[model samples]
Target chain A: MQFKLDRRVHYSKRMLIATPVIAIALAVLVSSVLLVLLQKPVLLTFHSFFIAPFENFYSITEIFLKFGPLLLIAQALAVGFRAKVWNIGAEGQMIIGAITASAVPVYLVDSTSALLLPAMLILGALGGMGWAAIAAYLKTRFNANEILVTLMLSSIALQILYYLLLGPWKDPMGFNFPQTVMFQDEALFPALFEGVRLNTSIFIPIIFTIGIWLFMEKHFGGFKLVVGGLAPNAATYAGFSSKKAVWSSLLLAGFAAGIAGMSEIAGPIGQLQRSVTSGYGYSAIIVAYLGALNPIGIIFAAFFLAVLQIGGDVALVSADLPISAVHVFQGLLLIFYLATYTFVNYRLRIIRPLTHSNTKPTP
Target chain B: MSTIEFFLAGTLSAATIFLLAALGELVAEKSGVLNLGVEGMMAVSAAVGFVVTFESGSHLLGFAVAGAAGVLVSLVFAVISISFLANQVASGLAVGIFGLGLSALIGRDYESRTIAATEGIAIPFLSELPLLGPILFQQNIVVYLTFALALCIGLTFKYTRLGLAIRSTGENPHAAQALGFPVFLIRYCAVAFGGLLAGFAGAYASTIYTPLWADGMIAGRGWIAVALVVFGTWKTGRIAFGAILFGMVSLGELIAQSMGARIPSQLLSSLPYIVTIVVLAMISTNTARMRLHAPFSLGETFDGVGPR
Candidate 1:
């Protein structure tokens, strides 16, 4: 028995080390077959994917630009996931935030104040929270499935974006286009450097990282949420309200998603549109898990995901890969990451079937 | 306004897709695993069905191809989670993501492609009835098939030996194993069955309802189907009712828009999600309120080997 235990532990350790490497090699091999079908050179296609993202500074910056929103949303999701509160519809919450925060500059575009941008951003966060709270409230009050509520809300948010773009928020000066009016000088997020899309949005992520780390490390609320997830019955016995934890985790996610939404519009697009709420809200779930649901780890994971997005775009333009190929790569990464963990905490064994006459016979 | 007529048409339309997807999820949930790839499977199948039907002009061929594609993707999920012992939640999510990606890639050429759909297969005498006519008889074959499937499923649960084994595998795998039932085999079959149903649902949405393929045509309906299982609280009868309610809400916005109602159409469009949240809250809060339903061992991953 002792010998078997040691062998099993050693086997697991080896599997853990080789798992990601093996999965990536397999994924790359599969992608090569796909490329061959596309009548593209597999060697060049492979190079353009793994190495080209880091080949130039220009591409690197673009990667960070894409990583910004993913970082924010993934961090938000990690909070709720750790607490076991599934907020699957960050896309809807994101759109709500973008629409809400854009309200300041859309109607009050001319208001030049030091506080206008900050105030609008805060409103954006509130919008995301408000959207998430609907799910949280329903779940807490009625035991509604948060997953469905969130997913359904995302579609509704898409419709709402279309309505806004077509109706009051439509750009009057433009031709027949589905987009909101561009923000004025005051509303646009300040760029930190010229010729670069990078801006104050990076600070939001930095602050969130520190805040989440400290909250998880030091705060009572954070401890309760994590503990609630690890042992729900113990939490209840210890007088912790599972409902309170649910609200906090959900509300925090909303806030983070909301801010990310606002950042998307204010920093990059500088306007509200149907495309404002992309699949980042949903993809962040993968990002959260890939980061191992840890605050510090998520930062690296978010950045890595951002690189994949950038690499995808680069491969699309230079290597002649379609947008779908990048998405496929992302999917491959998710599958590999998820599959690798099988070797983490589990040990496998086989034994002969039990012999019992008391049990009912199978037909 | 003939609200009853409108509601009936809307509900049946919704039921065609929801019933198919929800039934598949029901089987998966019953097998002690939650595979959240229903939405992704639907999306992949939707695109595949659209492309096939567009080329062959045969709805049957398209439906079959879609189902095969869905099963193929779900097998990957089953292999990772069931065989590898990967976290079911994460593996399912990965499968869903992969499905979406695969569908998008394979169906890229079929974007904006339109095809002939599965039209209503009307029953003779039933179609003549006033209220129940359009409600039941005048719908496509899939809608009628759903009712039959529901009945057969319920009967299988109560009377069939195979059903009993499936149930035992879910409730207690160790007990099932000692009794000579292969728990893993039962779960594998259940999940694959779910994939087949989900594929049909996706194909139905693409071929019959929309008759066109888009990147995100399934949207989040698969997720909605997952919640339906919880709301039905695990009873096939109640789930059918719950699926109809969801279907109605889903079609409500379109019905309102078609009728040219004065409501801010966007807010009305969101009613499905709002109702989903409300219904879910109601069902999940009180065990009794769940209508004495819910699978005995839903979403619990069985390792197939445990202490007796």
Candidate 2:
């Protein structure tokens, strides 16, 4: 007996929505087995892993705080991914944005103008776009693989961040620690609610989601990009320049990732530090996929992923599970989702081996 | 040993890790599959190898288990990317992320643990030779095996039918399949073989090179291995050279820092990754050359029913 996969002519909308749900269920089941193997109680671990994050108002706000960056980055990445122009180095771009945005507070420490915040956000977006432009230029001119170039560039960005923090950017008055001085009141983001760490930046992703939905669903440029990805020959025949698609996709992703980076320092951190990276860039990739690369889907996906992160932390203290187990769960979610995504386009069927007649032997 | 000798020895040991992994990736790519999870595979294997060696007190067992662990993880990759026809790049990334998390979880207890370091065996009579003896004749068994493996791969590609089949499959899977070759099976084996080598590389890092278990000890060597394949233009000899070059670049930082160079340590630390990007760009810019050497179906999914 053999199993065969038959390609479906059209993917059903129902499966499109159901696949992620199924993948999550499967991932939870697998994690339960893993928890058992580790000698942790499955029920208690599950409660901490999935349920504990929403147990309080503060933790709920924390989830939104995490969601802000992830959603922004994922939405940005989805644009590029849809165009088949992968910009995996959003992490690097985000870092550059953080640096650029922080330059305002670091250089103009005494300035308290209200315009400073908007200027920093713009500068942050520009910084990210500038970093992504390197990959864009290499990809367009030199035909370098964006995947490798972007990934390598991310490491370089991290190193640069380390260099600045440990050297030039180190706060002189802070006892030689490798971090920058806290931003002034004007540099920091205003909190969205009293006594909550969540800031106005949360609205950034919410607004971008609507903007992305319009851009992807209604804009001609987006249609061209989708054409380029789905069928390059068709795109070329229609006179849509692949170069423009690549540039637009990367720049947009860079811009969004930059905003995310700026929001981190401006919102929760209020200071530039090495820990600002915190895997937001990488996690955004999983979020982008989990959201099915749609604006609305990305909002939910980002929220789900953020909850996982917060829940993972809570579980670390309450369940005695290693913090790394959270990372493992994230990884498993992606793998499982990718595996189940196949079902959206293909159905499995069992096949029996055909028997051959022995007429020649009888003769 | 003089600084030069020390650098050379360090370069050999460092290069061996990349050489092993890259050679395996080269084979997998030749058979028309790309496993970007090399970093993750190495990380997991490093952790697993460290724990096994620490508990069993046998480096051989550690190395063996590490290779098996790599294969096991890669099998997950194969099942998803190959069987399910998922995007190869994303699948590889998932595997890598999974490996990292799995390694971190497994190595939680083993953090900061040290093991008996594997020592290089001195070749009889050759140890008496000045300068060259310490650099070449005295090295760990894996270092010698790397050289042998490179030679064997080169010869196999040039002279063997299996190599021809793999090259043919990578070039045109449809043609290979129509000609009765089992494309999926070949790719599966190729990917599995890559995993085994990656595992060995990881084990070597934890048990021999550093002789210590630490989270992320493999660092970015796995990614370097992936880049080396492209940098070498998929050639065994060039891959070996690229590995040695990267190994030297990585060690150069330590040498510079130890010698009290005033450059920021972070800049020095990033040299290898920077060089990897630069080298990748340089090699990839020559499209004609890349087309000539890169497997045509390198990352394309074969669903067993298509002409493509």
Candidate 3:
């Protein structure tokens, strides 16, 4: 009645690809049981969760709209994750990004110059980088754990956002609301197509996907980062600095997250609001892992996650399901994915007990 | 009550929550596993404890159920990180996210519900003592338990063979494994214990401290507990001190807000987290001290392999 896991000498590629698919299937199966427990109509809930998101052009566009931030943040995170540099504070970084990007619209309310958008994007990226730098500096110089530092920084970032929204940035004419005024037309992102919320910022992820694919697959720097992650001692033996890996990876993630924040404010949100603290930064972590930390995989993974998010919203309205159901689904998805991912590197086996008579005979 | 007394009283309860959670994490980290799902575990247990207490009308039963719920969530984390040999950080994050979501779902119905606050027990002779008695002796049973737990844990680490085993396990799992200790099993237990305490802390928040069930009510106290472990340099006494210090700081902000401080409330709210960052950075800056105090295998996954 004993079970054991034996590590495989070579990882199975098939299992690597199949793990996510199997994990998603398993998550859906388990979630159905949860729906039953929650007393929701399982079939109808499933229909809304899996099928209804694609029912209309608006919802489909909404999926891409959500996909924009997830893709950018995940790709940015995948870079650091590949380097074993955990920057879980992208949420804070994204917040800072949004805040920094808003400065232009908030202060230069009447400006129509085209440079405003570009300047805002740059400032947003810098803001995210600045926030991430705190973590990086601590990790590199003081040997602080980046995970805790980044997370703490995110809380600080949120407070800063709240302070601004509640104090300085509160729209003077919006009847005491704790939000900024809508951005001017110059600050807003131009739509990419008619009849949808999708904007030109979609190209950022598309371009970065190719850029990351090339950087990871072909660049020497990327190879060094991989080496740093895989074998730290060997990396040091080859003269690769771990500190550089930490900085580059975190800064890259910060930059991308900053862009995500910028796009969120400029594209979909159109202003810095309390709602911008939505868990895109956290969800992107799942997206990064779900994509197996690869660019191509991240695209599909981000798309699936976006669908879940958008579909979860639909279920909230149509199936009378709790909004927390989506969070539960995501959490379950990550757990299941991690569990199934083990099959790529290990195989399960059953161990039978030896009979006492046989042992006595041998004696 | 004087402002100082009010502050001390508030600090005692606040410190208790952090202390309970931090003590659990201390044991887990000492055994060489870092469970970052404290936030999620607290959230779930908060919801569970609140709902159960609201329904059963027994705070004791609520605390017990909350601890069980915490253990259940931690078991999921143990399976993922220990059995599956997944990345501990990623696994912990997943557990955290899942716990938050699950708790929120369970708490949806109980959002507006409130429970009677747990009354502080007045020590017959001690309550008549000067300032110290009111601050220390007159507190909820859980608060006293938290202090006792810290003392027991401290004594355990210093005097017990079990403490040595845990220390050795965290210091060098491979060596411990070769010595016939079941590394994975020990880690699983440690993680589960951490969850239990974190759950108790959450229960305290929902059933006693605030005495209300709200989605996400645990609100970063779990994280503060996590930081407190590091801030204390993973020692029991220092951890208690750090918890009390943070508790005071947190309460100070509320007091400041109440006293008509001009500073934005959000800025005041951010004080504890910012302090955590600063203190963490300061402590970590002396790499020599950090390396000495921190378990060498703190976040490393242990395979069931003997030393080669």
Give lDDT per model, in order. 0.80, 0.90, 0.90
Q: Cα deviation in Å at residue B286, candidate 2?
A: 1.1
The 10-residue segment of model 2 chain A with minimum total lDDT is: A354-363
What is the TM-score (0 to 1) of candidate 3?
0.97
For each candidate, how many residue pairs have backbone atoms clashing (under 3 Å)? 7, 0, 0
Pairwise DockQ winner, candidates 1 and 3: 3
Query: What does candidate 1's lDDT look like per residue over A231-304, in tens digits?
Result: 77889999897888888888888998899999989887888877886678877887887777888778877887
- Cα RMSD of predicted structure 1: 5.1
Model 3 steric clash pairs:
none
Which residue segments of model 2 deviate by more than 4 Å?
A230-234, A354-363
Candidate 2: DockQ? Answer: 0.80
Name the TM-score of chain A in model 1: 0.88
TM-scores, one per candidate: 0.91, 0.97, 0.97
| Higher-ranked by TM-score: 1 or 2 | 2
> What tens-digit string does per-residue lDDT give for candidate 3 at B1-308?
56677679879899999999999999999999989999999999999999999999999999999999999999999999998888888899999999999999999998878987777998899977788778877888888889999999999988998898888899999988888887888888899999999999999989998999888788788988999999999999999999999989888678897788887778788888888888988888888888899999888877676532
Worst 10 residues of 1 chain A by lDDT: A1-10
